[model samples]
Target: MDSLSYTPRGVLTPQRSLADLTWLRVGGPADWFFQPADEDDLAAFLKALPADVAVFPMGVGSNLIVRDGGIRAVVIRLGRGFNGIEVDGETVTAGAAALDAHVARKAAQAGRDLTFLRTIPGSIGGAVKMNAGCYGSYVADHLISVRIVTRAGEVQTLPAEALNLAYRSSQLPEGAVIVSATFRAAEGEPGALEARMVDQIAKRDASQPTKERSAGSTFRNPSGASSTGRADDTHELKAWAVIDKAGMRGATLGGAQMSEKHSNFLINAGGASAHDLEQLGEEVRKKVLQTQGISLEWEIMRIGEY
Candidate 1:
């Protein structure tokens, strides 16, 4: 592409391996891997790429489950060159590829409390797209706006409201690449924030299998009615509890197993292929549905193919 030459310092690779790019540590090679030098390079590359070609932008893939067959498109992963964090008063503008923990720490250092993002393993882009949240605080709460490059190669700024963000999702266009996002965080003391984050990490480590080869949560809690004719909210219901109650905890299929420690988390016991992980999840879902009246929706994004 002309954009490879357009930026003298950009990183470009033809048919790069994608296996290690995700938290799942699985995926075949990408047709192309482009890490633009900066915003200008990104724009030029997108503008010059053939219209028929597909562009997939990824960050630190925490919430993803890439299939074994791999993605058949150009993959764009922003580098440190686009990972700068700028804090101005209560507002923080961060590059899409910035780690959620890094952004939280930077904001915390500035006396702003974005500490809710302190433990999420994904990047800013994934957080924005997935509306990532913890401890009842979701990205839809603080996001002010985001700058995105559309599949048509045009860049634009959009307010969070325009994204129709809700729960664990956003209306971000499929094929659109987020360059940067601005969020509004409340204020907090650095010391207190750090201490709280430390405690939170410890709590997570104990309750969840933080060291296991697994995505954080496998399913979103089933919401609404309980079939008792009473209005209900499952916000208090734990996915693991339900799975355990359904007798699916510690269930295994090949190298994939529902974690014995945390029934909600699926672990690659060892040599687990994407199919094993996916099918095991499906098995868990079926068991939950049969035993309980609730149906679980996947929280981890499943991409590529079987």
Candidate 2:
């Protein structure tokens, strides 16, 4: 790649190992890793960098599996400068790096109901990108608008409608980095909201393998409907049920296993390479297709070379 015309104030590292950066802790390296000092630094760096150089905007790595061979691109990670949260009336604005749980608590403290985010992993950016939802509430239900810096370094605010948000997916302009999001929440008493979130957390911990090394849910429901991915959707098919019927619950290959607590969860029980986890998932998929005749789609995002 050609040298950049401008020098950014941010820290940049070459061939940075990515295992430590991901929740799975199994990826190789990123060709370049950039942590911008601020929004201006990020924009300028993207503007000055060569057009052919790829850019990957990463959240907290909560729902990702970067491959063993690493990413051949500049992986941009937002930090403190981009993690501010603000509340005004029923509207809450949060930076991309702000944790979903933090945003939920802050909004609840301000007497606005965003308690659905309290149990979800990762940041607001990833939430918006995936249309994350829980307890019948979704980012698509509350998101008003988003501020993003396009791959060309042009900043723009787009309405929530601009993104075709649906079940576990949304469409953003390719390579655009989400800087912040604004959500209009319902008004509720702080005490009541806190209580609701507490109950939600208790339920999640009881059902999911919260203490294990896992990347949330492994597969999407096989319904293929475009509506929200609620537990009570019309089609109402669950991935875990299918996995259980296929007899792959608690199944293991190498160090990776489908969690006994939640068959939909793919966990690293001990020392698991990315290959082990991915291959095990593929095996589950193959088994489900062969036995149940239902194809499963991955919910976790996997990237980079293998």
Candidate 3:
């Protein structure tokens, strides 16, 4: 038997396996998983949930690192009903659950310039949460406002200013759920925009290991404002270069191995444990710091437990 206060029109349960939800295809069971029918069902369910029961909203989990021990909270994931994309004039109003790449294509097809999102394989909510960016354009550059469901079950519209959007971060409440967002897209030729997307894909394929079973860039670019940042190189030294210098490009721990194609990416060759990946990452960081005197910052969001 199971116990949960809010049951959605779709389904509600505890101990739902999360491996199928993430791009990494990893992670343990969620304490409770709720997939409501629509906005109202989601709101009502949240309102009825107990105050002490922690809630965690997740998107497609593209940039997540859920540990093996599992998440001990009610996990709310939006689907079908919350996956619409609408365009009015030059603005795109999208459900947080909508895929970034899909929305990008829709915008491009409609002559709106959002080509930067064409290759990012995550949802709108994840893009907002991570302030996700590619090429030169960033999500923060086009966001207008977003709707959110608070931990206490109240829905409200929040301006970009209030969210305090910054590089790969926002002041999201501990368990506040992003519901939708409006982006002000620019006008551009559909053909040109799509051509640029193809070029972007080719560039990524040439540079990063896009096809391997790995999380994307393992570390954030050290902020330019870091107290003692590196000198401005035409192309700054990324995580890969640093790890390569440390002789960890193809390093391995258990089933986890630093990708040979792109040194920055770490892969689970097969049956790799969360601890293995985490440890491998730490080892790479330690080696890089010891050899180069530069600290690497993690970009992948490691959540849950060990």
Best by lDDT: 2
Is candidate 1 or 2 superior in lDDT? 2
Report how far residue 68 has shifted in candidate 2, in Å: 0.4
TM-score between model 1 and native: 0.91
What lDDT is obtained when candidate 3 is compared to the true structure? 0.81
What are the per-residue Cα lDDT tens digits for candidate 1 across 30-104? 778888888777877777777777888988777778888777778899998778999999999999989999999
lDDT of 2 by residue, 161-229 (tens): 999888899899988999999999999999999999999999999999999988898998887755454
Q: lDDT at 167 for candidate 3?
A: 62
Candidate 1: count of backbone clashes, pairs at least 3 residues apart or interchain: 0
Whole-model lDDT, model 1: 0.83
lDDT of 1 at 18: 75
Stretches of model 1 off by over 4 angstroms after superposition: 1-9, 224-234
Question: Which 10-residue span in candidate 2 carries the lowest summed lDDT?
Answer: 225-234
Candidates in order, TM-scores: namely 0.91, 0.98, 0.93
lDDT for residue 233 in candidate 2, whole number 0-100? 54
